[model samples]
Target: MKNSSFIRKDIFGVPVLKSEILESFKDLSHGFSTRRGGESPAPYDSLNIGIAVGDLEENVKKNRNLISGISCSERSVYLTQVHGSEILVIKNDSSIPDPDTVKADGVITDCKDLALVIQTADCQAALLYDPVKKVAGAVHSGWRGNVFDILGRTVRKMAEVFDSDPSDIRASIGPSLGPCCAEFINFRTELPEALWAYGDEKCFFDFWEISRAQLQKAGLQADRISVSGLCTKCDKDSFFSYRGSKITGRMAGFICINN
Candidate 1:
């Protein structure tokens, strides 16, 4: 499967969805949204997918609809994204509740025609799919979530829920603040011990590396995984970055079924 790219513009004339990886999975619809599309104004600019970010509810709804159109899902399921390691199993009924009502960094679902969504600015957004089992999962992995191996946990949850095998799983690591731009302070405490446990001080803390390592540990083949090396903080025009702009809007990473 060769990697390709595509851009989907929001109704408001913003390039809301863009994908650099996972282009091979044309049967499945997925994209990473930008902040250029929507109805929000000022602080939120136009497209702010985050409802709790002080953006108006109506604008958030519109932005969501735009995303849903690109993903080809009726509606996208949002996660509370507490930066924790919690992984939740999602069913058809699971989409009814608001994101605030649920707490999880990752969610997995086998239900057809449902979209799995995750919000991120500087944090890593991971999308996983097992074509064989027809299972999908979305993960929001911030530094805290990475420390606890949330990606692996999510894959394990998928295995339990859909009897998915990691080897059959295809994964895409969406844009985020790359290691070159993702610096940390007070690393002694802010970061977990497992990071230093491997004795790679020169390596610093690369979320991409951590994510890839975790995915491999979960059994996904090296060829099945793709990483978007784009750094949100570095590419101001293409993505929204919390570290690049503290009060910036959030970008969404979504995966869904065409049915």
Candidate 2:
């Protein structure tokens, strides 16, 4: 959701999704990518960033180059994204492959030399930063992730690995399927009853609110959390929604600290 509501910018040509909440952090390079400004053909139409989603690998490489360039990255780390809670921690001395073969849904780093990337079509990409500890984390969270408390776990991982206190952490929930179109036909078996309260008569779930709740449980202040509030399904022109197109491109949510 790189609309006006988000900290929108045209980087060379791509519409980048940024968080105004994290904008004040002068030493961080973090933003989400929209569906525009790429070389991939229709279905992926312009800004498809995912390498395994049927798009031309060469085209994805070009888009990836643009993304890394925006952050002025020396190295970029991408996750395999299994929709699970596993997280990868990157140290300053870590040597990652070019295409990023790590298999995890969340990534955390205290090093400023590498940028962490998470690709998403409709799932929420939750970016976290602890200014006090100078640490950053990025999560690939969807309904399945929520069911396992992935956001909270990522926060805890930051604390365990980076010595970060959740109370001092600031969060940004990026564009994904909003409550308006987050319908789950078998939510009763998919989600807990407590979360069922967020469902509408039509079965739409308030994932943003759910993210907020998860943040609270992890100890972040309510005011410290920022929500993009942009629905990818509705804003199909600027975003990629898996449910909207079934075979659409993925938006990139990237975060990195500055040296």
Q: Which candidate is the best by TM-score?
A: 2
Q: What TM-score would every model get versus the actual structure?
A: 0.88, 0.95
For this target, which candidate reaches the highest lDDT against the unseen true structure?
2
Candidate 2 positional error at 14, Å: 2.0
RMSD of each: 3.3, 1.7
In model 2, the worst 10-residue window by lDDT is: 94-103
After superposition of all CA atoms, the RMSD between model 1 and the true structure is: 3.3
Instruction: Identify the runs in model 1 with alpha carbons over 4 angstroms from their true place.
Output: 1-21, 92-96, 197-204
Clashing pairs in 2: 38-46
**lDDT per prediction?**
0.78, 0.87
